[model samples]
Target: MTITIRSALMKNFLGDSPDWYKWVIISFLLLNPLVFFLVSPFVAGWLLVVQFIFTLAMALKCYPLQPGGLLAIEATLIGMTSPAHIGEEIANNLEVLLLLIFMVAGIYFMKQLLLFLFTKLLLSIRSKMLLSLAFCGAAAFLSAFLDALTVIAVVISVGTGFYAIYYNVVAKQADNNSQIADDSLIDNPEHQQIMEQFRSFLRSLLMHAGIGTALGGVMTMVGEPQNLIIAKNAGWGFVEFFLHMTPVTLPVFVCGLLVCLLVERFRLFDYGTKLPEPVREVLKEFDRKASAKRNRQDKVKLVIQALVGVWLVVALAFHLAEVGLIGLSVIILVTSFCGVTDEHDIGKAFQEALPFTALLTVFFTVVAIIIEQQLFSPVIQFVLQAPPSTQISLFYLFNGLLSSVSDNVFVGTVYINEARAALEQGLISLKQFEMLAVAINTGTNLPSVATPNGQAAFLFLLTSSLAPLLRISYGRMVWMALPYTLVLTLVGLLCVHYALVPVTEWLTQWNWISPPSLNVISSVTAH
Candidate 1:
């Protein structure tokens, strides 16, 4: 009986995950303490980060929250980081937490409208290249004002909806023909190939859209969370912030669009997969049925959601309230008038965002460990100690490297604070400070697209329901994003190194930027 119970418990652990994966997680649990005790806490902290990333990389096998949370709990219990520090990290990023919780849920409620619009887009745009460009361009434009996560959530919903519509059609046909007994149709080779082609097509568009978020996400103060932090420290308003980033962002944005075209033109990196005709027919039929079945009430709901979307854009652009609060207001308005008062119905909206939100909290725990261990301090110190002439480029490059491996927001926050401290000590002039602030903002935003771990949008997409169905994994995402990452990072770095100083000089002469010496500011402005 004892042996049977032990077997049951082992079987219950990480249910359905491969036995090897289960053992790997178990080994990670056992190894952390030994490394923490016998080795330096710093090494142990870095090890924990890598272990958490391993969980993320194997996300298709099991959710990262369970395994990553286990590591986080162990790290805290072993005194690598305290609960208080974790709480502090969460507190520092409370706005982002709220955005994930409320904003993404709010987006969930708008899926009907999103699906309707995107279906039309898919059918109308016959060219795969144009369709890809549209997805990328639209995401970029939306992300410039709305949160990147929110924009991606919308895309994920639309993509999943698109996938579901066609998948049901295929499954039903397969069932009628009795060619495949399974629901997935994996046994039917022809349908399997068609599905694979469709998945590839969707995957490419999703990747382009993901990169698009990064492209536009660097343009404004509200683009990314860290953009606001850097803007506040540099004392730049919206127009000034936009102006400051234009030197780097504009060039990168143009190059990014061109890269989008080139990749599709050459069918590089698994892009340019034309939408399979069967899948297109399925989507077209679904769109036709949807449009035909639309009643006045349904039309009103779409209109309401559309108006709310407009309100969302305007609200975020004007900084009317904290992002999450605006998102809450959206939830209230949409649910109140759209005839969705049922508890279960509203609760369904939370399903998509809550898991990722929990994972984000786990991410903060890892960030807390980084803080306690000062793992990034040496990099911070190195950049700060670099010569002034080269400091901007160094800050840009190092922030990019660190952000690619860690959370970009955390990396940006730390570097900006350090740069502000330098400003206070008169080590760097306000002119140089403004330049560094730009570097940090662009650095964290542009280059961090290299991996899912680097950008929250990419991470969200990787862990999202759409990822597994589309066969998008961590390595796959890195592979797809390679071209955009290269173009954005290289263009951004060159512009920062060569174009930034000249642009700043021109802005200063135009009185758009005040000369640091003429303005005797006491210290960097705190957010």
Candidate 2:
């Protein structure tokens, strides 16, 4: 009886995951406190950061939130980071939290409209290359104005819908043939190969679209949450922020589109998988049936969602309200007008966003630990000690390197605060400060696409319900994003070193950027 009870307890603790994973997590938890005492709190904190990333990398095997949150709780208890510090991190990023919670859910409610529009594009565009370009361009445009994660959510939904339609048709066909085994349909060699090809096709387009987000996301103040933070610290409004980023962002944007075209045309980096003809037929037939069944009311709902989507874009572009608030308004307007009135239906909308929101909060705890440990201080200090002539480019390179591994928002927040301190102390001129601000924004946004770990949107897409079905793993994402990463980072570096510096100097010489007056300095110092 005693042995049976122990076995049941172990089983309960392990749940559905493998026992080895449970032991691995337990080891991570056990090893941290020992490291904290044996080495140093700083060393232990760094170890914890590494362990948290390990959990994220193994996300397909187990949800990272459980183990990551456990690590966070252990860190607090062991004095690596205080509960108060974690709370402070959360408070500092409340806008981001609200955006994830409400904006994602808002996009969920708009799926009918999104699906309708994407379905039309998929059906009308016969050329695979053109369709890929359309996806990339549309994703870039939307991400420029809306949140990247929200835009990716729409893309994922469309991909998932198409896969479901194809699979359902395949399943029905298998049922009609006795030679095909329903249980082995996914595992059959020929069928699996075709599915793999289809997945590769989806993976390529999704990567293009994901990279598109990064391209447009660096263009404006509202393109990313970190951009807003940097902009606010610099005392720049919407227009000023746009003008500041334009020097680097615009050229990078053009180069990014060209890279998209080149990659598809040359079929490089695991791209160029054409859609299987049978699957294409399945999707086309599905669209036809869906269209034939649509009535006047269905058309009206699509129209209503379109109007609400337009409103969302306009509101975000004008900085009408906090993004989260605008997203909340979108939810109310779309649901009420489009007849999504049932409480259960609304509850379903929250399903996709809430888990990610919780994971984001857990991420803040890890960031809190980084703060308590001062892990990034040495790097920031070293960069600040560089000559003023090279500081902007160094800032860009440092930010890109760090943001590729850590959270960009946290990195941006820390660097901007440090830069602002330098400005207040008269260590850098206002022109230099503005240039560093641009570097911070573009740095954090652009190079972070090298891995999903760098960007919240990429990570969200990697861990979404769609990823497993599409066979997109962490390593796979890195490989797929490689070409884009090389192009964007190189182009961004060149623009910063050569183009941005010269343009800013020209603007300053022409009085386009006024010297820092006392009032301006005071305002910056006060903030």
lDDT of each: 0.82, 0.80
- State in Å the error of residue 316, model 1: 1.8
Candidate 2 regions exceeding 4 Å error are 1-21, 34-39, 170-183, 186-197, 276-278, 417-430, 505-527
Residue-level lDDT of model 2, residues 1-527, one tens digit each, is 45687688768764777888888999998999999999899889889878887776566667777888899999999998888988977886687778777877888888788777777877788777888888888888878777787788888878877776666565555324332223355555766777778888888878888988888888776677788678767766565677778889988888888888888889988888888888888888877887899999999998998999999888876778887888899999999999889999988878877876787788788877886788766766787788875788999998998788866765677678678767877777877888899999999999999998788778879978888778888889999888889988999999988899778667657866554452246548555
Q: Could you tell me which residue pairs clash in candidate 1?
A: none
The weakest ten consecutive residues by lDDT in model 2 span: 174-183
Candidate 2 lands at a TM-score of 0.86
Q: Tens digit of lDDT per residue, candidate 1, span 1-527?
A: 45687778779999989999999999999999999999889999889978886777676688888998999999999999999988976776677678767877887788778767766777899898899889888888878866788778878878887777777676765314223224456557888899889889999989998999999889987678788667656766566788889999999999999999899999999898999998888888777887899999999999999999999887876678877888899899999989999999999978867887798788788877876787766765677688876889999998898788767876787678677766776778778888899999999999999988778899889978788888898889999999988989999999999999898889878988667544325334322
Best TM-score goes to which candidate? 2
Provide C-alpha RMSD values for all models, in order: 4.2, 3.9
